[model samples]
Target: MIIRTRAGALATTAVLAVTGGLLTATPAAAASVCSSPKWRVQFYANTTLSGTPKATFCESALNQNYGLGDPPGVTLPKDNFSARWTLTRDFGSGGPFTFTAESQDGVRVYVDGVRKIDAWRNVTATQRRTLNLSLPAGSHTIRVDFAAWTGAANVKFTYAPRTASTVDKVRPLAPTGPSVSYDRTVNRATLLWLRNKEMDIAGYRVYRRPATSTAWSRVSGTGLVTSDTYANLPPATGETYLYEVRAVDKAGNESTGSADRSVVSVDRTRPASPTGLTGADARGGVTLRWTAVPDAARYTVFRQKRPVNGEIQPVVEAATVTSPTWTDTTAPERADYTYSVSAVDAAGNASVRSADLTVTRGDHPPAPPTGVTTADSRYGVHLQWSGSTSDDVAGYRLYRDGELAVDRIDRAVDDTTRPYTFAYEDRNARYGTTYEYVVAAVDRSGNETRAAAVTHTTPGDRVPPAVVTGLTATPREDGVLLEWEPNQEPDLKRYDVYKATWLGDGPIGSEDGAWAIGQIAWLNETDTSYLHKATPEGETVLYAVVATDDWGNSRAPHTGQEFAWVTVTELGTPTEG
Candidate 1:
């Protein structure tokens, strides 16, 4: 809503004056004039009398008869010359909208940068009109000049996009898809088909078929009427059935039939308990979550204002989704929405509505919660989420290997760290031994979700040692100079060198029930090379570095000691580091 100040009118005569008689030669491509519009009082002389008999509106509301010959005894209406235009076609967008008005004398239609009718002229009021206007989708501007021609005149113009839907084409009208419902009283079934885009869309048809048979029977009345509900459906009194629908246009154009909507027409009485119900304002959208029923084809989600009557609840937003979730961005702000959901069977019958849920949206995000999953023999089990974004999360907390570990924080996980990752070498368990794990996300709020459980077997942890660089074991004066190029991880926290007599023998960290042993002694500092104390007496001390990087991610064990060629001389008690 804006007010436009009237400048004046630019008649076709001005084009001749500016370009020196260039009547048809590209009138200097003036800017569109819809950008600026003017309003004025007008007179619609119904009765063809003499002087101004009555005025619908005038230049000014008070100046009823300033120029016309109307006296003070006559009352006049306010200036009624106003109109909002819609574009039929536009040259470009954004306007230097320039238009021209052609009136003999006493009238003018203001356009951009042009003025014609200075004073009244007695000449015939005839002028070829042209308007250059910037055309936007919705509202626009129009120009008209109908001054006192024989006592009165009529004001009229035409435009497009009379309604909001005419401009926004993405609006969805009726629900589409196979729908089924069941009835209880007669043990019958009812099918519903909806095909609607605009209020002008016609109606729908319902096709019925039994679960055991392949043939279908089309109900009466080619769906050309006003209603879509099909009555007296399959009277099997609790039989599963299938149904489908097609839409017909006003001109008798019938669209292809929709996919079948399957149903079971359960007890046809009360609906089964609705499950997986949850609510949240997620990722800038309102989401209602639910678990899907195994045999149901569609979940009927209903929304309405606070209940008003005693029997039926007012339904506002009724929509369906492929899965169990329904989203509504149209929910009003600061207002509560009551929702009820029902499962519709393949037999064209719907269960009674579930109890309503009142949901509200808040401004803040819910705190991060803890959860976990497991992958057999894989350190990383994968992480999933259910809560809101964190405002001050430094990183996350990973729990594994019988202990809690930190993976990432205010810092994001590098190519190295991951979620659901265990930080310990519990690989010693027998192949079928079950291992436990969990993960938790820590936010600036220090709040966390309950830890989730993950159970998996170690599958003998037999994956070959993953060495990044080369691996080699050389015999040296210090029993065995068991050295290896350390993993190049700056997050290298520490390294535990393992020594086993045989390549396939038990690892040095095997406990009572575990074959992996922790006896190999060269615990080298994370930053230095190592010469394991006096080579233990055998072809075994197969050295491998379990490098723990700085961020607490341990490099998978890599073997360096090729014990097949090296032999160690017995040392003092063969002490372990």
Candidate 2:
């Protein structure tokens, strides 16, 4: 529970005129007027608060101390006097609250005219009284009364709402008198409303919606507005929009929305520019097409002629159309021109022009190439196609995997049987890889027609790598160290070392079967040397090396002078023992 002191002095004073060392003949009339949301108070000459008040002024709170002296701006005696403070304020969706009062003499508290706390007894020290109560929603009046019979005199009273969400489930009242004003120069709408009366109000939420829409959007963002005013920038489309505000309490409960306010926004927004504009020469004329723009009612096309030399002609309006496509039958034949487009809305606002497109009038693209075929070979991928039937066809272009691979090819077979036949081999293509090829035909005017496309996967490599050469073996105290030249094949996988024991021989024969051959070591493609540590001393050993490819193809192992043979020596001997 939180307790707040509603403490302040009198807000207004009633002047009692005194003339010529004597008081005025007319007594000052009692006037009770306090600023909004402040307490109204009255002071009496008697402790019973009977008869007319000696002074009636406004106070912000009931806290006061007049120790052996009269109250300020009042004629009440120092002792045997009384004062009362009262106010009627909205509690909104009220919940639990704590009321407290402290006094040196006597004090009492009342809510809506019903007594809630009473400490009506004279005391030498200040006496305190507190009580908890559940308040209902809406406006209620609170009153505090204090009397001093003798000695020091002081009194204080305060009340606060319990804002715990679990204990306070009441929602605040809706904001009142919501109004809006629009500034056409800045395209902004300012909204103002009366603040909620709830003491526990957290903040306000402002919402907006188009006049034609039933859905509302929260324009205040994720956070609540702590002020009574808000500014929003609605679309300046000359449309009418509505706005409303709601009050939120500390418990997170929101009230009903306030009355809707309307504003007419200025029309300053323009339609979006056209996009994806394309122009092509056709039999009738030059045709232009573009993507439609949202909220656009029509479109305008602009054109300019391209000269062979010097600066291009000035751009001029070509046509106005409602649809996204238009044809210019006025364009002359065999001429080059550039075109652009812009979109217009119903409000007569025109957007920026679209990107320019160049087209040659009466110059049509050649027909696409046909009879496209692909074949896999050991060399690479093979592509074959027939030329376009169009007489204006100048050359051909090839695209591999959507990228231009061959820029131009002018040569074609001159044979009468297949006069337009063409073939191309892609030597850079790798084996066991897939490729997509496209064949296009170009016209004299540089217009290319996308043509036949073919997909092919090359066969896997089956050839073995070259035999290992320059192999050398040196007998050491630990073992025989063997080395060889590395193979250059791209698909080489690894190398294998073979060793055989020569029982009795000057030179080992290729077909010798008495000596068993065993692979002593398998090294990766990058390794070019190996050390055989398991060789027996005093025995002649033949070492052979072979290269293998990724496809499991290996060179045949050979035993000759190329394959070194050395006799193992003792630990300290340089020659065979």
Candidate 3:
């Protein structure tokens, strides 16, 4: 509840004096004066009633009587005397009111800056005249003028509400503090205003007009007697509307309209969901289709990648189209992708997602293997080559001597390094056998690339190479450096160094299959030294070496030559000096 101080009115009265001589007359007897609120009264000694007055004071009422006589300190003429009264007061509530002016000569009256009565003339006897009025609840000013041109000089005035009769002559007060509110979901607008306090208030009338038009149309019913609030008024979405209100009394009198307020209605309802969503795989793309939705301004496309590792989840908006069909030209072949569509209304409301459609791109072959090479042994051959770098490459296919030896070689076969390459050991060949090896990469779509072929010939039977000896490990600034005596075999192809966490149970060290041949390539078998950099810290390291002859026979366990080892205890990550 809000309270406000009622503004008070400023009351002021002025009396002007004129150059008129006083009139002589015998003292006259007094008559009864009307009873009413006090009024500022002044008497002038001339008919024109101009200039300073002979008598001025606050009169208890407008009624007064003097008969051809003079009062004790007064010297005003009785025949041509004039009088005026002014009153300023608050009416509290606006309603129909009446005013009566009785005078022996002529009289005039004014209310709230408006002249309501005028009968200024000469007359023989006191004649009474009445005025019907409707006054709004606020401060008002009333003024009366009278002239006594004859014997007995007298005047009186009175007023009251004319609500029960046909005296109403004024309109009700205008309502204040008008406001408007709209609900987007319901498309309804409500109007409210300050209540009218007029005693004879019958009801209020509500009106509205488009913001762009000046013609107002009534919104409320005939007589809204109980509520100052009008609700459930339909307003077009996206359009501006203005509202105003006016007060009316039981006598059908109406005040001016209140100030107009405006609001723009919004559309918040979502469009219907897209239906019949379908998709098909096209050349290098995916084509999607769906049924058109009523009132849908556009359609939005969303995509979700395959649920495999690293895929974006829940999908996201991809594109907006006015039509019901869309093509995803950027979809990659042989990859899993799912699509969905949604309809959007003019107000930016999007419908729920349509059913999902999954697609796998068309087939595309893997790239060819590069750098193919082979090493021959007394029995079979060994192959090493670079693997395919394509994301869809599933494995390799190996062909030997113009025949397929491995149809599907899983990429995991070479798990020794990141981005593993292809390596194989062919142990099915007889001595002196000539062979041609070819390798090709296959994709997940079953497409294979052109093979890269290499030729090799197995060596004739010969004695195995001598064992490598005198192996030693010495600590260096970078890491442990290993040294060993060269093998006695004149056809030694290379030397391979092996390391492990020396469990110390067998000639090859502890046998948990922790054996791995270091990647270092020793082209010269006579070069019997190797440096191991950045070895794992806080562990005993074991080192061993095997000598390989041109026939691919390693002089260790392969040829019954027990491997000799050198051990370094507590090796730390090497540091630069």
C-alpha lDDT of all candidate models, in order: 0.45, 0.79, 0.72
Query: Rank order by lDDT, top first?
Result: 2, 3, 1
* Candidate 1 regions with alpha-carbon error over 4 angstroms: 1-82, 85-180, 188-195, 198-202, 211-216, 235-239, 265-577
Residue 504 in candidate 1, Cα distance off native in Å = 77
Model 3: per-residue Cα lDDT over 114-211, one tens digit each: 88988898888878899877677787888898887877667788876676536575677888888888877777888888877565677889888888
Task: TM-score each candidate.
Answer: 0.21, 0.55, 0.35
Model 2, range 481-568, lDDT digits (tens) per residue? 8888888998888988888765444445444335666888889999989988853455566787788788777754542323333333
RMSD of each: 29.8, 23.4, 17.8
If both were scored by TM-score, which would come out higher, candidate 1 or candidate 3? 3
Model 1 has an lDDT value of 0.45
Ranking by TM-score: 2, 3, 1
Which 10 consecutive positions of candidate 3 have the poorest summed lDDT?
1-10
Worst 10 residues of 1 by lDDT: 57-66
RMSD of model 2, in Å?
Answer: 23.4
